[model samples]
Target chain A: MNDDDRTAMKKRVQRLVYMAAGGRISEADLGRYDTDLRQIGLDSLGYLNLLEGLERTFGVAIDLDHEEDHSFLHTIDNIVRYLVAQGGEAV
Target chain B: MNGDPTRGPIQDALTDCLGRHRGRRAVVGSEALSYDELGGRIHAAAGWLRGVWLEGGAGGRAPRHVGFCLGNRPEYVILYFAVLYAGDLPLLLDANFNTGEIESIRSDCGLDALVIEPAKAARLEAPGKGDQVPFADDVVLLPLSRPGAPPFEPRPATQVCRFTSGTTGRPKCLEFSGHAVVSAARNWVLGTGMTGEDRTLCLAALSNGLAFNTSLLSSFLAGGELHFLKGAPLTRPVARRIAESGITRLVAFPTLYRNFVAPGGPDRSAMAGLKHAISAGAPLWPDVREEFRARYGLDISDYYGIAETGPCTFEREADHHSGLGRPLPGAEIRIAPGPEDPDGPEETGEVLVRTASMASGYLNHPGLFEQRLDADGFYHSGDRGRLVDGRLHLVGRTQDHINVAGRKIDPTEIVAVVSALDGVADAVAFPDEDLNREALVHLVVVAASPELTRAAVAAACRSRLASYKVPGRISFVAEIPRTGIGKPRIAVLREQLNASAGA
Candidate 1:
């Protein structure tokens, strides 16, 4: 993936996460760049919805392992890396 | 609480009352369910279910146990009654139950079918879980495999089978007779002064024992509209719902009350026609209770009841001085000493209660109900409370089970999940409160493998247990302190976590 694509993917991921947690989690509750959603008071139900949203948004099957690892979902950098690795080359 | 009007089956009463009040509104939200509309939806759902069973070549004699996972929605009420109306036992499963947990319930409770949301249905990868059959617009039904051929024995008296909350990892299914369930609702209406004119907004899940016993039956039987709030139970939404729905009674746990009263906003008018707020399944902190009273000018009624037994006590006055209310007329209570102590009934001990509305038995486990339901017919509540001036003041639980908000987390469930990982020599899970005084699972482990980490355990648990059961904090310890009989001393572990968190 190109630099522009990677950055765009990261932004889309962030937006989708926000959309999934629309009413339940607040943006202010999310912590520093590396903080996980669990640390931000996002309950398990939030993660489930986030996973579903990501799947629907990116058309990718993401699992719980990515949710737990900091290098996968806890930060934008991790999420970008995951999306790129999941063959995000098209378009 | 004392009057037993020899009520008929709840499904019958609901149908009759709904027919009588066809023009009246039953549930109001984005859309409304008039009694006539609600009855149509229930009939449609029941007809669909009956047709599915008939197509599957199921005999009319066999009444299957049908499980469903649903959130706060108008369809929940419809589907629940529809299942009963179709001669199947409505089994309410938690929406958070993972695939493995669902399978375990199927095997243990002989669950024949499961209706869950499509997204949830995708998560369940159980073998032979049939192709999704659309049960409702929001949820789908998947047939589960139950091998036990129980010779088509019908429990004519049992209306619904709800799982009870306990610290034990093994779930126990409690069967409530139609008479018992109806009586329980009528008693609450009689005891709490719930009138047909009242409008109730329930914040808790319909499957929750608190809501099932108090709100569902009492509201409908009293001819009140039971409003449901979707999404999280945060303060603003709850306040907004109360205002919009003109909710006179707000049924929820204590933590929500704390959040609502924390801010200096929301006057009596903000809650629209709200007259009363009910809190149960956990203790209402004194300061929070006092703050609510001072700000809202309304007393928070504290309710006390057991899952096995029906409504036990209720305190109408907010300033009961932390005292629980007296028992209802028919419901009897005995405060006996702990099993270890040789105390008499006069002294404060375990709260043993026997009511006409007590559960018939644990349908899942053959002999388990007998163990809790004493020979004298009183089910031991496992809670320690003292009756003072004819009012009950709860001391605490005799066991160290963690009650997080209203959800009970079995420490053993956590231990089992964590220990299932590849390299943990020993592990202990306990409940600890954060600065907010809300409960979180805290775990300590003696890792034999250097590769084992908190993230690994949490990830594994996410796949196995519900997210709430996952540990908020995990630490490596040398060894867990235990009693001579090999019981882990959880209180010491709680103290250690408190000290470390403070640092």
Candidate 2:
């Protein structure tokens, strides 16, 4: 993915995180793409909702059982990188 | 064989059930375990537990308290039965409980040992912490040294204990007798029409009353297969499991049902094998229920059960679309008259439940459970509901606790945690919905200083409380409206917040 595409993807992933947050984390606080989502109140339930949102929106099916490393879901930047690696393009 | 002199009724019943279905699959997690294999494992685990108790110098004083702080897995099942077989009381604690709650449980009710995951056992740094013995692959038996006696004791007949959210970090432990538990399982099996062919896919935490009453012992009693998902209950994985395992029954909370009806959810074919969909913990939204039925062709049976009284009622008929179904067998529901309709039979008041599967009492708080009971043995459920054509329809709760998803969180606990965090001033927590309409704890804080940010308050709460107990929404206010007696005027506060948001 190009830099511009990655930036757009990061924005989309951040939006998904904010939506999944369900007001648990402020939208402004979610601006930092590298900040750990859990540290900003993205709990287990939030992660579940985020996973569903990611799959529905980006078509990236993250099978947690198969993925040995869960850090891909820790931050927006990581999520965008993982999504791009899985062939998910900027919509 | 009539009964074993050494074993309790629960253990005896379980042994009989397992022996009858020796060749059948009992439980499936990462792998499947046959009834015969499960029985043998339970027998061996019980023997090992007895040895542990003897080594701990509590030999003659059988029935030590063993806390289960793990998730829904086969090891949890095997060890739970083994605890009972070894003549010990098993306390099923929410696996999400933090170290503070675990310590409080240890101090309030003496825990001889805790069956917990190794990762948690590694982080648990307590004063009376003892040696950790490996039990299963990822599970361990961490013994705790009880200094002197605990503040409270369980009743002699109390065989198992489960907890409800309590104020100030101490979860109220409800003790149940062996007979009560066995009766609950048997009634659930009989009422739900479960059979040996039924494969139950339980998604709720086994510590929760919904899964505990419906799936745990009842599956074995009916000689059925109990299945547990390895990871989170995501829609795709759950649907895949249902399709692959031929799961006949799905016991989950309302949030999951809502997800099933959401856009991009799994197709109806994924849930083709499911015959019964049981939803509990909190009220299922009407729209979600209808949408789920329209999409999946399955009517979600919204189950009504209480922590004090086991499984109260279940909808038996597939076509019954009305109130929470008629009371299950061994259960009776009586609606006391409210002031509006004193002479009518259909009066709506507190739901009074008298069930053979009722809990004995609260082990921690003495007489707290009895305080709610009336002249009859019926326990006041605190829920306002009227019986309509023999079906129980709930109106609302008389209590102040907030129901987030399926877990009942005491708002006072959240308020206490936030208020203590150099939080300047007043705070009140109440139930509110998020963008997705999921239930969440809304904490409104009145900060004394301008320096206190939302991040600070949220950070304090995240560190001190359980993940579920943390408030999903935090708003700062100048002052909180209170009644003359210091009760929060939640309706007024909600109006003010809404007006400001619209401004």
Candidate 3:
């Protein structure tokens, strides 16, 4: 994906995470970048729902096997990488 | 020869009452079946079963294990008693268990024959290579609508298998003799203050030990009536029946109680006949218990028992702080010192019991059974508890203790505190090891509101518990994960968490 598309995807993923989590994510922290939901005080269940929401929002099927490796899901940079590799398979 | 010495303790109690008070009421669904009529049905079922068993066998041999997967109905009551009277063992399989779970349990327990509802029977999967049964046709379809027969004398030395809840792993078979039934009946009567006048609402399945002891045997032996609900997700009609039938007591889990005690819900005010309510399967959350008690004007009795030993300790007329109440008669409890404290009975330890109704061992797993059964035959219940002020206090499961970071946190303790929080309906703490640092991840069901924040929940936990005991992270949910019986299914919650992470 191009830079503009990647930026939009990242913003959408973060929004989806907040929405699934009942908007518990602070508004001030919305635009700011975070590696993973865990760093933003989201629990495992939170991180999971974040992934689910992102998948549903982006219409992509996440590769959960690789997602288990923290390198894939720990930070926003890693997660966007994982999503790119997912190649936009619909949920 | 009337050889069934293991006959249920309540059999003679009912029979003797039947002889003097034949006009007394019993139950067949909503209908008030007189004692004589119920006795007649038991007799008839016994006679029909005897004939069927003899026909199926070469030399009058009764089937060792007959599987029953019928819903809660009058027929199940008849069949269960008939199986006991016929001196044949009946395997009570879960009606709601998935096809795979059902087949796995049936095969693992080595069911010789099974009786299932026609619809459920059709849903059975075809046998695989490892499957011993040649065909689905190998299972005999017992006529559920068959009439009662003459009560026949049972042959002796009979045993039946009831599967454990499989909370830890694949369900294990716990064997119970006729004597266990008898002992359990006597204990139920003494423990619950059951009399001939008390009418019981049979909410729990007859298969589980709690239902069998508290409802079936307790009612039969006490000369009280047994009212069984027809289907699951008990509807308004069922609730109306419970009130209309004048059910004096209901022995159920928390989930069912939540349904009955919902906001402006049932005609609970009409249920004036209800004298007491009993809860088991899992620890009754204080809110649910208080709600039930206040609505019904009855003290909620919290019972603690396992398939290994039937009806060990119960909260009979107990205050909220008594833990699980004292041990029932013919039951002895001891707190086995944990590795943390191997000396005297401190605050908490593994709760073990020696009971007249204790199972001999787990079926086919002698070593597993032996590990639980100690030198003097005390069953080593993996549950941790404390002996406090001559009363037993259950802490939590030994296996369920999650090592969050470096500190061990009992999910039960977290649950108790979290459940009491405002807008927090329920909570389950599960182990989450991320990057080799194990911590507890809490799934919390909160009331739908913008104010229900994870930070608020964290603050509540901080105020209620120690620093190390607080959850590492919290996720808001609409409802907590639950098992078929309404207990907080911790494993299911963990699975849902994992699936969430994967997505």
Choose the strongest candidate by TM-score: 2
Native-to-model Cα distance after best TM-score fit, residue B329 in candidate 3, in Å: 1.0
* B1-503: candidate 1 lDDT, tens digit per residue: 11221123877778777867767778865578888888899888877888877643223455678887877678788878887777677888777666666666677767778877887777778876777888666578777776665432324577777775433345667788888888888888888888878888887777777888778867877877888865556565667778777789999887678766754345656764777788887778888888888777777888788878878888765556567788865588888787655553457788889987888887766667778866798888888888887788787777667777567777887887788789999999877654456566777898989999766776777666666676665678877889999998888877776687599
- DockQ, all models: 0.08, 0.72, 0.02
lDDT of 3: 0.63
Q: What TM-score would you give candidate 2 relative to the actual structure?
A: 0.96
Cα lDDT of model 3 by residue, B149-193, tens digit:
212211243355676544322355666666776788788789768
- How many clashing residue pairs are found in candidate 2? 0
Better of 2 and 3 by DockQ: 2
Q: lDDT of each model, Cα atoms only? A: 0.72, 0.88, 0.63
For residue B432, model 3's alpha carbon misses the true position, in angstroms, by 10
In terms of DockQ, the best-performing candidate is 2
Q: In terms of TM-score, which candidate is stronger, 1 or 3? A: 1
Candidate 1 RMSD computed on C-alpha atoms after optimal superposition onto the true structure: 8.0
**What is the Cα-based lDDT of residue B201 in candidate 2?**
95
Where in model 1 is the C-alpha error above 4 Å? A1-41, A44-91, B1-8, B55-59, B145-156, B165-169, B339-346, B495-503
Q: Show where candidate 2 strays beyond 4 Å.
A: B1-6, B54-59, B339-346
